[model samples]
Target: MLTSSHCAIEIVAMAALRQKQAFEGELNRIAGTRLTLEAQVNAIETANLNAETMIAMKKGAEALKGIHGNMNINKVDATMDQIREQMDISNEISDAISNPVNMGIDVDDEELKNELEELEQEQLNDRLMGAERAPIEDEDDEEAQLRQLQAEMAM
Candidate 1:
């Protein structure tokens, strides 16, 4: 009877030990699976970050390309050429106004005065003789002089 009881206790202890070992094995498997899943999640996050960086770089490159297109060297040169031409024209006009001699616009004062007096005399005679009066243009002396100067400059 003593030997039988001892065998029964040994059998129970062995079963309990096997249950503990199976539980530990199951926990180890679960832990290993969790670690693998975490590693995969980390890899996916890193890939996403790299993808975002690549997309940002592409966008920046596109923006630079647009700027380059808008600021092309040929267009810049053409615009500068137009500006230079306008500046030259402005300078020439300034020179012409400041110094008429540069544009060969010389006039003899005596000759101009004599011609003006003759025209005035002719108008006076026409008014005295009761000639068929044409419609007057109402031009002042200064305006007439300016017109005459412009005509001379045109020549």
Candidate 2:
């Protein structure tokens, strides 16, 4: 009995070791894939940044030229003032709407609302698509058949 128990324990320990090695190998493979993906993302972001920098440089040059040329200085100032006023109004509206008291709700979560809206939209789309079926006959025939069925059912 003692020998049999020892054999059983040894078998379990070997299996456990094998499982551990397999898990470790899988973890390493996943880590490798993650690193590769990160590298690819970095490369793409670097390229995007380079392009944005070039565009910003060109825009800045044009802006400086316009400023130096004094092109409609008063018009620019008026537009800036109008923009500032609009931004202030926007901020006020945002502050009011974001407040629970203004919203008249105790637990108002914008994220939850957005998620619920998305789910509702998805459900609406599903119902629209799922309820569609081929027409059994022409519109005239269908109307006549429906009327006949309704008359019989009423009787």
Candidate 3:
């Protein structure tokens, strides 16, 4: 009777130990699966952050490019307007110089010309008046007188 009871107790303890080992193995497998899922979640979050950053950078670059393009167009238009204005001014100057008579410009100074003519007439009158003086004695008559004196001395 004692031997049979002892064998029965050993059999029950062995069964209980196998059940504990199987439970521990199942717990270990569940823990490993949870850790693997957590790692995948972290990796996905990092990838999402990088993607969002790249998208925002692209948007900013596009916006700046559009603004710069508009500014360049405006600058070009302003420069062209200035060039056109300069060309118009140059053409006006050329036309004004080409047709001075039509623009009421006097080519000659009439007052200055009249004054110069009056002065020339006055000088001519003065010269004519000077020419009316008595005629000068001839140098030849004086030389003949000197020669007659020298002949008288010689005699």
lDDT of candidate 2 over 43-140, digit per residue (tens): 99999999999999999999999877865779889989999999999999999888766445566599889999999999988877877674465579
Compute the lDDT for candidate 2: 0.91
Better of 2 and 3 by TM-score: 3
How much is 153 displaced in model 3, in angstroms?
A: 99
Worst 10 residues of 1 by lDDT: 98-107
How many backbone clashes can be found in candidate 1?
0
Clashing residue pairs for model 1: none
Pairs of residues at least 3 apart in sequence or in different chains that clash in candidate 2: none
The total number of steric clashes, by the backbone 3 Å criterion, in model 3 comes to 0
Best-first order by TM-score = 1, 3, 2
1-155 in candidate 3: lDDT tens per residue?
56988989989999999999999999999999999999999999999999999999999999999878667777989999999999999999999888747456555788879999999999988887889685677779879899999999999
Quote model 2's TM-score: 0.35
Quote the positional error of residue 108 for candidate 1 in Å: 24
lDDT of 3 at 5: 83
Q: Candidate 2 at residue 60, lDDT? A: 99
